[model samples]
Target: MSQGIEAADDLAPEIRQFHEAINSGYAAHPPQPGQTMADRRQVAERVRAPWAAGGPAMARTDELRVGPRGVRIRIHRPVLDRGLPSLLYIHGGGWMLFSLDTHDRLMREYAARAGIAVIGVDYSLSPEAKFPTALEEIVSVIDWLRQDGAGAGLDPSRIAIAGDSAGANMAVAANLLLRRQAKPLLDGMLLNYGAFDHAVTPSHQRYGGDGYMLNSAEMVVFWDAYLRGPADYEDPLAVPLRADLQGLPPAFLAIAGCDILADGNLSMAAALRAAGVPVVANLYEGASHSFLEAVSISPLADRALTESATWLARRLGRTCG
Candidate 1:
């Protein structure tokens, strides 16, 4: 291991490998000055491609256009069955980078492990889509599921939402929106190392360095790119930690102990508990942001996903395989 990886003693061996892979990928394709967003996205896709390959096989996979925005959604069903409880999964990437293709294996792992369908959304990215645009598309997908999920072999009444990082932020925000509209909320939430707020907590100082999958500086850029202006900082829908967490569904938070966002995730869990919401927070010590992507190699990542799958199965009113 290089000095950089070895110095990150807090990160698990597999997670360290994950970081190395990411760093090497980016190193091999260093960003050029004045690169377009499209260029950056291509770089991201190339870097993340290997991690998304070769996982549990699905009984069936289907693609469909959903909602007024014609948002593309990919559904992975573990077994051929009707009325399956489903998880509506949103991919992270600070609301800008990743896609359904990048999170393919992760979604399949969840579906196969939990014996449930996983619906991955290809929501619009930011800097072009802006705030509320992706959020609205997500809300639209939720609505579509309720109205037409049966046709997709999903039991709409038993659905849950899940995501990592920015995706996690939107999951909670979507629930909050449903609450405000007096609509029936989803069954549960599975939030993994979500960027809940823009606050610079102590965790940022401790783990926001370069080796971590995400850093404070990158977070600032991501938030800036996703939001329209300073006004969004004050919007509860944009910054979920600023919102009232009451009446939200039971949440299972896969908190990464060594992540820069750890403190914020902890705070979010506390807020959920204070609001009388049921919460199961499993803090994975020595893990960094995006550590779950190491499931292909890391036992820690595998254990975390297994625990989360069990929780989601129970929450969605089903039993894991």
Candidate 2:
């Protein structure tokens, strides 16, 4: 069985309260007629503003371009280590929404609490950018880090990768691509409540509906917006769970026990283990998908992030204190 927080007898009260609060807010401010995707995105950002506000100070921060896709990335280094280990951090929003601005605080926390550097990739979003595009952009970030991390103030060998939801999928896909090129470009991976393959699973059957922040129906809409066609669903890079796991780096996967995507995380850890990749998997009972967004308020989210960071830090020889 997996270690860390096990699925509890009942949902955590903080998470339950968060669920009720969001449900009530959504009910009170029902969507307007003809609300565009942009509109929904703006609303999501506004609602998340409070949780995403403020964080530990960084010693250095820089914005740079990776390549022609115009993918911009923000690099954050901790005050303690000028040459800190780094991780390419991708944000989660069903691959359609959220960005560096939305996940700024989250990255800062990892940089500070885990004593590592963080590069937050501002890759293009979907219905405009589509699948593979964001994936390609992340691979570009990984390539650039491998080439110029020393110049950019990060330790190359210690550079790992991480993300929540679709962002995590991109991290895994990027690692697979680099591996194929005979350039294994990661020290470790942190996947939090990821959406692996589009197929249904037992966890989906148990927790895939009604106020989990990422219900099964919304996931369908997300996949449709993120992918170009049905064929993209089967692409190993696009699905990640469909890809072979051999030769992958060590991984720390965080599963929200009540999340619809819990089974995906479980399956991925199992596959990695079967392939002989070291894996440390955690199941945070009753935590919602993207609940890491509530780091300041939820003890479970804070603890899970700390533990995942610690696991990766130990593997990469960084400090998780």
Candidate 3:
């Protein structure tokens, strides 16, 4: 075993293999021009996610304008016949990359696992549209759903918001705003290894350097891209840990055991509990950040998603067959 993988003895063997595969890919095709956001995204495209493929058949999608910006969304229906609970899923790309297309297979699997219609929201990315832009887009989508589900085959009254990484950050922040404005309420939230705070945690200091798919340094770049200025870090809409946790939706925080954001996820769950919010926090022992992206191959990832779906199914008053 190489020194790097040996150092990660705490991680499960499969998790170690996952990281090794990532490293092998990087070695074969080292990242060039990886300094900028665009360049990094281009480099990321080379690492294949086999687990994201071969999901159940995809439901038809429709393009709609939630806000005046011609913002679009891709809606997927579970195999269930009747109207189903809806999940507004945000794709994680550190707030700069990935799209509905990039995350389609993963969303389809979630719909199949949870037996619910999934609305893959294509919110604005960062650097160009920072802070409130994406949050405002989320509000518009929720408002549109509340007013007119627009034949999206969803139980409008029962809806949950979910995301991974930066997307989870948005889900947490948007929940607070939606409740405060009384625009529309989210039933629950699904946060998978979310970075809830701007500050560094022990996990960041320990695993932020390398081996993990998501490094602490890369996240610093993501945050800098997502935030317009230093002041944005203190904004509740950006840094949700700084906000009061009262009255937010119940949450399912799926923690990656080796992630830099694990500590933050733990803190968020604890804070929610202290605030009297129902919380289900699970740590996929030995899994690294974004392991869910390998749902096809990672048993741990599949288990985490299935359990999260079960909790969300009950929370939304639905059953996943």
Candidate 4:
């Protein structure tokens, strides 16, 4: 009995068509040798480029330099005259793929719908730069935001960190690091199909094969490419689910029922609740990983995005039209 449930029979044809197209593409270019992670990312970017290029126009794009990494950050503001809370968004790709460009539509949609400023970080990818690099880059960006986001038309004090998959892991880890260091506090977290634990859960064991999307073997490849060594797997920064959840900010977790990572999300929510952290976990039935990206065409996708945005708006104290 999830809060938002959209029956499969009610799905739009366009959404089904979109899913078919994606599946066809995946089948045609199944993950193979010589197809490096970079190649996979390029494929995703190409598929998403057209949609991104045609998305709602933004007020402007700005780059924020933190340390030696010239982080490419984009700011999407609402059309209204009033200022609003800011969200620091991290894009998902299992830490191996995707960028701000790949997630342009979703971020812009969130910014417009939530009536808040959205800041997307183009953090360095893995296989080239491994674990701790992404973590360090995210922390630096947050620090820069806390210090200078106000000048960029964002309210620094109301900043929240958000992301999907590996990005969500980074977001939660960044918050934990900030809490540990007594740094600037975040208002909350918006986690979508987050990969909080690398250890195979029951769901992973069940859906480890293809057809469900995001196969377990592919996930392992990503994990290997991102981590420095076996020891990193146990670190809280690498696996936030293992970290102490006490005193963390409130969280909104949207997990897909058919995803291999489902159980990990459920367990994380339970752990957070047990530790006294306010959490809202919604399991969307029949949805697969990365469903949020397919929302423009899929009815279930639309419902998930709507519910997530609504939750985010409530948490940020904003009203949607």
Best by TM-score, which number? Answer: 1
Candidate 4 whole-model C-alpha lDDT, 0 to 1: 0.78
Candidate 4 local lDDT, 1-321, one digit each (tens): 001112233224444354455556545556678887677877777765654554456665555565356677877776544456888899988788878987888888787777788889888888899989988888888888777766766676788889998889998999888877888668889999888988888889765564555678878888898999989999997899999989889999999887789999999999999999999999987777777777666678777777878888888888963
Better of 2 and 4 by lDDT: 2
Point out where model 4 deviates above 4 Å. Answer: 1-19, 27-37, 50-68, 80-82
Arrange candidates by TM-score, highest first: which order? 1, 2, 3, 4
Residue 276 displacement (Å), model 3: 1.0
**Candidate 1 at residue 182, lDDT?**
88
Q: How many steric clashes between backbone atoms does each model show?
A: 0, 0, 0, 1
- Top of the candidates by lDDT: 1
For candidate 1, which ten residues in a row score worst on lDDT?
Answer: 1-10
Which segments of model 3 are wrong by more than 4 Å? 1-7, 27-29, 33-36, 80-82
TM-score of every model versus the real structure = 0.97, 0.92, 0.91, 0.89
Candidate 1 per-residue lDDT over residues 1-321, each given as its tens digit:
011343277789888888888888877877699999899888888888899999899999999999888999999999998999989999999888989988999999999989999999999999899999998899999999999999878898899999999999999999988888889999999999998999999999998776678878888889999999999999999999999888899999999988889999999999999999999999999788888888999999999999999999988777897
Worst window of 10 by summed lDDT in candidate 3? 1-10
Candidates 1 and 3, the one with greater lDDT: 1
Model 1: lDDT equals: 0.90
Model 3: per-residue lDDT, tens digit, 120-196? 88898888888889988987888778767746566778889999888899899888888678765699999988878
Clashes counted in candidate 1 amount to: 0
Ten-residue segment with the worst summed lDDT in candidate 4?
A: 1-10
Q: What lDDT score belongs to each candidate, Candidate 1 first?
A: 0.90, 0.81, 0.79, 0.78
